[model samples]
Target: MINSTIKHLTFITLIIIGFSISFTSCYYDVEQELYPKPIDNGISCDTSTATFSVKIYPLIQSKCNSCHSTAISSGGVSLEGYNNVLSAQQNGSLMGTINHSNGYNAMPQGAGKLSDCEIANLNTWIHAGALNN
Candidate 1:
């Protein structure tokens, strides 16, 4: 009877140990499966006129010209036409306002900031010589 009881307790202890090991290993496997890995930040730009029309102009019209235009002219920066934009670029003022660290008084004040994608589009355009066409 003593030998039989010892065997039973040993079996139960083995089963518990097996279950604990399985459970912990399963959690790690699940964690690895759920999160594959993160990719790097790869940004590319196409210097096409259509890309400018489709990706760039709308951003300026929507975010910039409302405040920085001939009619309104907030912050003394007019972004209505190509010439005004180029002038700002030449004098290094356009990048200053666009890249302003202060959140409250940036261009398009009192509205939601432009998305990272939109800003990237503008940066690409500016970097590509700020073409008018």
Candidate 2:
């Protein structure tokens, strides 16, 4: 009787351990999987060749001009053309605001911040003289 009881308890413990191992192995972290680090995967960013007319202006117009254009400029800032954009950059608001850093208003006020690639491309352009090209 004693031997039979001991064997049953051992079997139950083994089954519990097996179930725990299987459940833990199947567990997944949904957040990490959703927001994995950005990868290139052979798709190029082309920051080196970005230009104002070809690359920068369209992006600015689409993202910034809705609130920052000449017609109804928000915060007294107009990103209508290359010169105005350059002035913003020179005054340090361009990077500060977009980067969501302190001491500057966060841009696209109610919208999501710019993506990393967009910010990197803009940085490349600014570092390359914020040209009118």
Candidate 3:
């Protein structure tokens, strides 16, 4: 039964090899963790076409609208529509509050500040003349 024994040993060896390969091949390689992203590595924020409808409106609706809507008007600020938002911007409170600049209240009060990308988007929009679009 040497032939039978040899076949069994061969099968066992194949199973061992398969398991070794299966176990070893599944290692994950997350490039971001290994290489890491550089902070402010010259990647400018995308502010082109930062329209009110597409970008600014949605951002305010989600973050600030809850408190600043016409119904609530917390702190007497109503960011209900285009005109109100425009007023805030024109009066310097929009950038001041959002930017958390001194002499102005930090908006989204009690929550973490808006992300840098968001502030950059607003800045770009304002720089582009703060149009109704």
In terms of TM-score, the best-performing candidate is 3
Error of 3 at 74 (Å): 0.8
For candidate 3, the C-alpha RMSD (Å) to the true structure equals 5.1
Sorting all predicted structures by TM-score, with the top scorer first, yields 3, 2, 1
lDDT of all predictions, in order shown?
0.69, 0.85, 0.87
Provide the lDDT at 66 for model 1. 77
lDDT of 1 by residue, 1-133 (tens): 9999999999999999999999988874555355543221234334344244676667778878878889988877788877887897788766666666553356556776665555666777878867775
Q: Compute each candidate's TM-score over C-alphas.
A: 0.55, 0.66, 0.69
lDDT of 2 by residue, 43-98 (tens): 34557667888778888898899999899789999999989999999999988999
- As a whole number from 0 to 100, the lDDT of residue 55 in candidate 1 is 66
Q: What shift in Å separates residue 62 of candidate 2 from its native position after superposition?
A: 0.5
Say which prediction, candidate 1 or candidate 2, comes out ahead on lDDT.
Answer: 2
Q: Could you tell me which 10 consecutive residues in candidate 3 have the lowest summed lDDT? A: 36-45
Q: Any residue pairs clashing in model 1, and if so which?
A: none
Alpha-carbon deviation at 110 in model 1, angstroms = 1.2
